[model samples]
Target: MTLWLCQLVTSLQSCLQNKIYDGKTLTCTQTFENPMCLTFSHHCFLPSWLFVKFDVSFIVHLWHVFLNVHIKQALNFSDTYVVHVNVFVSLQVIKVYNEDNTSRAVEVPTDITARDICQLFVLKNHCIDDHSWTLFEHLTHLSIERIIEDHESVMEVLSGWAMDTDSRLYFRKNYAKYEFFNKPLDFFPDHMVSISSETNGMMNHSQLIQTFLNSSTCPEIHGHLHAKEQGRKSWKKFYFVLRRSGLYFSNKGTSKEPRHLQFIAEFSDGDVYTLLSARKMHGAPTDYGFCVKSTKRGSPRDLKLLCADDEQTRTCWVTAMRLFKYGMQLYQNFIQPHQKQKTPMRSISENSLVAMDFSGHKSRVIENPSEALSVAVEEGLSWRVASHSLFLYVSFRLVPNEHHHGCPVCFAALHMAQPWFHSKLSRDEAHRLITQQGLIDGVFLLRDSQSNPNTFVLSLCHTQRIKHFQILPVDEEGELFYSLDDGHTRFADLIQLVEFYQLNRGVLPCKLKHHCARITL
Candidate 1:
């Protein structure tokens, strides 16, 4: 059956050649060694004849050429290119030593910080510091020493940067949640539902507090304070209340927000639990020093918890963030793309991944092959094709959109001359033209010959349709040229400019509406 099928197809090359655009039947004509057919049918029916009479070899060659063209279209030079985006920034905020505070943005790794971002804030009167105190102040919680010295009792408690003798023994006996009223914080989502009225329909804050407090031997409060203040303030108010109720209240204060309040509480509990257990046996005041202690089970390891339930404990922790060594390696790694996973290195890389190369016109295929997958990446580039005849080179450098900026295309065009295909406009000339005309760089208004404003089609060389063309300057140099769109300036810039003016003159007036100079990536 397969042999007959091959033979049948082999005789159809002649019919296929004559039926290149035929929308009728499955035209099978073999003109060369290649046995193929171009089928166009509305119904499920084979051709009337089983085979065609043509040079099968010639047909095969044509098929190969066609296949190659399709494959090239699929993976050759890019109609869409990659933009080299880079997000190198930093943040500048005034440092008030009043209290140790941990902010989400501050806690993030340094590479995620961009100099430009920092500068922006700095320009707006924010303090920008690039010193060791700033970096270390944010990364000390993950220290190995602290982790080793904690002695928590439950699974949740044990994991709180300490060793847990009771938890270790309890795990050996009972590992169920309900069996011990203990649950891991990791078990819950970052965002959780809450039903407590005191928390304004938020989760039970007191339960979270108790859980962390019980895990450690002592209660701690942490946060920042002015330079005049001292370290670690005891919650005298809560202490008296607990004392009157015959309960021990060790609250530590911290500058970390409510989210970290839990972690600090739990960590403090583990250490405090161990120390209190030991001190109780030794009949000591428990407040002898700021360190860890052992447990009743006689674990040789010294375990201590800093209770940061109050502002003081929180302050200490915040201070710790500042003390932490700037993890340059980890910070850089996180900010950059994971090369092994083929993820972008930086936000800029992901953003600038889309681009084009129109230096010449040989129908260049889309550049970035990965772009075929429709992912929510950054809008990398915007191409503005010239409509008439002038060809001008425009370049721009843009910050994020949140910075309140607009497009730079029209501003670059105002001073550019026409018949641009052969103009000799220089970068200085173009700059002078726009600056002298006092044209704002980014706004545009496209129009047609009827003297009415409208969008024009800018097409590629081989394109027969009048489609709006998009052009992005491929040159990286922060310079470009412009000339008259008419035949007078025939410079390179003039060629593109002329083409643009002849086709869409209406785009001129409103060019200054919200224009900004183009930012070259």
Candidate 2:
């Protein structure tokens, strides 16, 4: 039994020895190769340990090689990387060049219109609103978005708003071209409403305004200035009172008179003292004169007269009245005569007298009253001078044609003819004929289908063939006259002309007489 045990032990020992030196088997049997397993050799244990040490050194070198390949590449990548980019805008393309006989790099304005940059020569600057502004027609193309986006760069190009170098910057090139004007920086909404009433004629005081003080009688004075008194003053103050007795309606509706009075007082220093006025209309003619009185410290009787004489006051009033009458007479006799002779003024009334002036006067007023009525109607519907009438007659049917075939009466009267009832016009016939006849600009009264009046007047006037139009508005009794010029007029009579235009169009024009003046409350 002992000998059998010995043989078994020897076999087990040889198997263990073989497993220790065989690294491949050790690797297969365990997750971690045993580095000290080869050092446990039965015959050469120490020498085997050296080879095991060499293997460990080789594995460490290989780990370092693996790290060198990947970790070093990562570090190098981090050192060279950039996440964002930067670029500089080209300044040359945005710079402007002045047309000099010199070649200096002039800074171009970012706001420049194609028209401004393209000009070949240096020109004198004018305001953007000046008549000469038509030169930079392309300025109409700029838009608000483009302007704001480029605001930082545009300042260099133009002189500024209103300057000749400045062109409109935010209007579209197509329809409805609107120019930008600077509005008040600090706006008070309440102040705007004050102006609104005055503009719309809805204010309480508007109806009271009348042309009572004849401009001709009033001596024109420069604006009043307030100066303080240095020494003893001769007069404390001067006052004016508008009284009822001065009111007298003129024969023509053009003259206006007020029923009440407005009195204003001013100190010797030219400062306003007070406003004292009364309105009295008792259904009877009231004749009265203005009373002037003075007052001292705390007197029981508050006033003493500086000058008091009713006859002298009346005489002064009469002299002023005479001057006004003379001025009116001068205008009617001298000025009006010249105007009438220069241009024919035709006045139409509700009932027109069939005079023998234009018509040949057939014996016993021949037949066909309809045809004569039509002729008279055409004259009433045509354009006439102001001396003729004060009404505007708008009509679609105008003068008659030569054919006598298509409302020939309409053609001669209005200078335009409507086709006869029986005639048929081709699609292009009317347009071609009108253009070919050179009657495109011809003035013809358009029938306002909106009118309800049966008997109306037509006023016609033509002077030097350079026609200018005017419209006048009169009150119910035709006593008050407010006149406005036609659209073709320049800014010479801007405020008055705009008022008429606005009224005609069913709107109120801004009441600012000039841009310089504020709309008074």
Q: CA lDDT of each candidate?
A: 0.27, 0.25
In terms of lDDT, the best-performing candidate is 1
Residues 401-496 of candidate 1: C-alpha lDDT, one tens digit per residue: 654243223335443322111123233333322222122222222222122121121221111011123222222233333322222332233334
Q: Which digits, one per residue and each the tens of the lDDT, describe model 2 over residues 233-352?
A: 222222222222232212233222333222232211111001111112111111212222121111212211122122223223322222233333322322332364676545465246
Scored against the true structure, residue 379 in model 2 reaches a CA lDDT of 69
Worst 10 residues of 1 by lDDT: 170-179
| Ten residues in sequence with the least summed lDDT for candidate 2 | 174-183
**Model 1, residue 376: C-alpha shift (Å):** 17
Local error of candidate 2 at residue 116 (angstroms): 11
Q: Kindly report which residue stretches of model 1 are placed more than 4 angstroms away from their true locations once superposed.
A: 1-309, 317-521
Name the regions of candidate 2 deviating beyond 4 angstroms: 1-125, 128-151, 155-482, 485-509, 512-521
